[model samples]
Target: MMKEPTIENFLEFEKKYKCNSIKVEGMPIWSLYRYEIHNEIKKQTVGRTAEGSEPPINKKDLLTMALNALKPFNYRNVDVLFVCDGRRSKNADTGVYENIYLDEISKKFNSVILEQPENRKHSTPNGMDNVYFTDRVAFKTNLAVKLSTKFNTPKRKRYEAGVRAAFTDIFKAIKEEFGPDITDKMVDEMVDRMYYYEITKKYCGKILDKAQPKLIVELCYYLINNFAMSELGKERGIPTAEYAHGFAFPTHTPMQFNPEERISVLPDYHLTYSKSQEDEVHFPDNVKLVPVGFPFFERERDRYKAKYPREEKTIVFISALAEGEQISKMAAEVSEALGDEYRVIYKLHPKEFGYYKERFPWLANSKVEVIDNSENHMFRYLAESGTIVCTRTAALQEGIGFGCRVILLNFGDTALNLKTLIEKENIPLVDTAEEITDLIKNNKAAFVNPNGMYEPNAIENLTRFISEIMMN
Candidate 1:
């Protein structure tokens, strides 16, 4: 029998093939491409296609460049610089998209935010200065790269040709290892990503030259611009960090780095939600894990705890992008089986926001109250609910912190991803409505160590960590 393409098998293949050794322009290219390769592996494992949100193309590149030049903003000698993607949410009162990860942290210093544009209802609100958009940065970088290509020196020309040849050879080895799953087109995409990083690094290097920030931080460091910032910040002797955006599950590809791998680019520090998460990942020697806790979660938990009254019978189903269909059906079944006695809330993942109505038509007619807007705070729902249901969401940890017992869905990779919770907390995994209904009625909850998941004094810890790094 053929071996399944599980993470363990993939890791073995990666070690045997020495994928980390693959380089482009002195970069260990495997770190840049591993996420893409893992997505394919996951698709095959789950029998589902990967979900993606295509970045908007800057059509008016020249116009944007001109406007930026006309109203240039200064970024010289800043205390901290935060690079964030378009994952933002509207404040319940303000209705403006806020950077949930770094908004609080950014207030502690003379910080500058470089945010990507997203197709959202509102942009970052006024009053706070030093907020800059990155579409123009991307536009300027692309033009500079094109010009550099047009007028390359003799050595530069040779280097370009060599890089192309190197990718061709690397693709052959990748094809052999991954079988027909790896493709020539995918290899080409990776090559484009290679050039994108190098050019973005050069462009951001100029900004760093002016800013000379004491510390640099990003939400998710794997993205192209953020990864470039990490590499550049390290080269310039500036501290770089990535905030813990979600739980570092064992099967999570981006978090699963081999210690022996010669991965070139990484943030100097990983600011995690709690110290307990330190064991969840195997990071490179250069990277340090700091338990800074979660300021946003803490703030929300406290605010909503005061604002809302807990409904003991309310069940909130936290959805994951990949397992939306299955979760929706299960949540509906549980709601119907329980009838008017229970209040069920189904929260859709951000990726599923656009097409969920079409994708899950039953949700419209189901007894569950669907929370789809980014404005609706998840912690608010948690504050009001007594029990949480999920398959593979990081929110399960947060749910436990809110004093809610969990009912994990039995299907999919829930057992694999949440193995620790199942063992330690004794969370129940149920497939049928009868199991869910019985669990709710019995009300026999397991003890969960909330302090282990989220430490006390998050904002203080984060500020102190930043201060220490800056002083050092």
Candidate 2:
């Protein structure tokens, strides 16, 4: 087994793979896992992390876990195909990797099996490659079903029903939204689903073709959307681990599904961010919950320099998906309510800044100032601002580290209630702009630093765990 992992150690490790018997002949020992490792290694730098322009994760620590997983396998031949899990596969692997480490890491890797980001475009584009590229895996057996064999009239009878059922589900959703009548809404929904269905169908044969897998590692991404990768991994009886890219069982997501379904779809090992996070989820006996603390939050807490005792007039609202417009509107309303003394600095998520600008053209005219998100770190906003309001976002979790007095906004209704899971002492769920205004106006909210949610040696714990699993 390896000790401290570095590119040099990895290169040295590859030297043992000179024998022909141990050489993985057909597929490059499935490079997807290595690609994830490469990305995690890249994550361990200063001012850089997982998602765009926010807090950083200790991804280099995660790369350590990845490297450690290889300790037990003293293989002689190292030809591997590091596949990308498309874009949606981005998530928490083992809790080992975080932003502080990931901050300075670069995009390139110095290994033969590892792949780069552009390699994904070549490997899994929406065009013909979405199915399967033979360079990665090309095999067929009576037990395995191929997409090409079932592409036509009677040959594809089993698949046609599934396609029809999907369309039916889309139409049902349309009916739910647009009332009991058929209209253009249903047509649009159907057309969109049909287009995707046809496109995705091409990938099935390519994905399902028989191929030997030494081990299957799902980047632990959107399993429902990208089930092919996970499903193929399971069907092949390969040892698979799902890296919890983010909250594996968030209040808003897989946690809402049936335990049986989640368990069935989940990888053999379900990695988590922390013990506090893992304790909340009741994963099945088959799924081991490996809790590695949040690397970004931990590192920040250690190095955090407070910027408090400043001007109290500015209010920063951390934005989330689908709630940007609502929060922005409320910021404007609150600014108008509180008059010129108080201003709402709406920190828009980087991805939706353009959309919000186009949606609210009067943004410049109002007291609400949309923060130039690039200019400052989110923790700065939490420290300097008066009150923080947000929808379901990682920012809220980070808020706990900064002693942020947060209010969870009830944006649009969904089955997921973020507060039920992410319970902290300071946060109170708010449903209206008036409630938020009252909190700010009355000075009812107080920011207090919480104790001990982060573990100091998370990287070590995660590395030990992944190594033990792979070693067995």
Candidate 3:
């Protein structure tokens, strides 16, 4: 049997091969390819992988992007440039997409540009001033690069040579480590990304030149566009920050980088949701981890608490697509053991909603009510439930803030990811439904104080940090 693919094994390979040292045209190409290589290795080794589908560019989204681009906004010399994905949730009351991470801080800045790639059905305009789109810019840049490759220009020659050098180094490392069986597939992935990186560089460079923003803030820094923007910001002496969107575990490869490498593909600052996250992953030495608190959780917790009064007999189980089977089975068993005394809500992750019934057939027979809507945020469920159950999810961390009793399912990465909370001994960990039943029936689990993890006045702290960075 072949050895199981693990992040530790891949990390070791990266260190031994000195993958981070590989570069093309002064940009760290290996960092951009690391995630791709990791996924490919897992797919070949395990015969399966979880790769999400990238929605194709439709006529409506393109039209929305065109309209957003035409809106008049001074893109020059802005205080900040905020970029986020278009897959946002529409605010029921306001009827506009909400950028949970940057909205509050965006209001603080006198001059800022809120840019998005393209509009999705779930995530449309936030009706805010100074909002624009960059899909057309990326489209044109990528198309131009594809059309201009036939000419034997000096710039094209330099690009080709640099790419060849980087590819040779990476292929040599992979061949040395894993042999030639998987080398071609991995190389093909890297080649595809090299072209994408060019698009990202030109797209980001154009936006930066036009805006000349004092600071750049982005969500989900691992995106190639955001990574390119960070490098561009460093080149221009402008600072870039990323809002940490999810929990970082030891298994997360994209967050880890060689501390010794001088060129960083990541943002200068990583704005985290809480102070406790610092202990989760070891990042590059220069990328500062700042705990700015999570205004979305804080705000939603209060709003949901007011809207839905807490029920002492309600239990909510947070589901993750990666661990869907194990988590759903546990939730079903617990529901059976509880015997209708408590109301159980199994909240499915957005990705799980489409095939959850077919994937987890037992859910249909289970007594628990499953919530599977994008608009119904998880924080709302956490606020009303007396107990929150989960294996692996950032929602477990947020559940701590809602003052709900958290029961962790000790399967796979759940215990590993939430190691700190487990060590604190305030939350209980159980492998079987009986253990969960006993804890909930007896009300034996203790709740941790939220302030220990999340800092207060999140928006104020974030805006203050932005101001300080702009001044320097």
The candidate scoring highest on TM-score is 1
Candidate 3 stretches greater than 4 Å from native: 1-9, 24-27, 43-51, 55-74, 111-122, 137-181, 444-446
RMSD of each: 3.8, 16.0, 4.0
Clashes of each: 1, 34, 0
User: For residues 1-472, could you state the per-residue lDDT of candidate 3 as single tens digits?
Assistant: 3345577667677777777778776667778877877767666655434444446555665565566556444478788888766556567667777777776678788555445463233255676766665565555544445444545456655656676666766666554554445655655445556667777787678777878889989888877778788888888998999988876776677776656645566888998877767776567788889988878777777888888888978999888756777778888988998988888889987777767888888889989889876676677788789988887677867777788887888876667666766887657888888898899999975577655657778878888899999999
For each candidate in the order shown, give its overall lDDT on alpha carbons.
0.75, 0.44, 0.73
lDDT of 1 by residue, 1-472 (tens): 3445566767777787677777767766667878787776556554643464643434464465446545455778899999877667677777766777888889889989877645422255633576776665555655645555567655345545555566555546544555444555555456556667777777688778888899999888887778889878767888899988977777777777767765557888888887777777767766888888888887787777778778999999988777788889888888998899999999998778888898988888899999987776788889899898887788888888888877888866788877777887788877876788888889854547666677678999999999998899
Higher-ranked by lDDT: 1 or 3: 1
Cα deviation of 387 in candidate 3 (Å)?
1.0
State the lDDT of candidate 2 residue by residue for 184-224, as single tens digits. Answer: 33333333333333333234324334233344444443332
Winner by lDDT: 1
lDDT for 179 in candidate 1 is 46
Candidate 1: RMSD to truth: 3.8
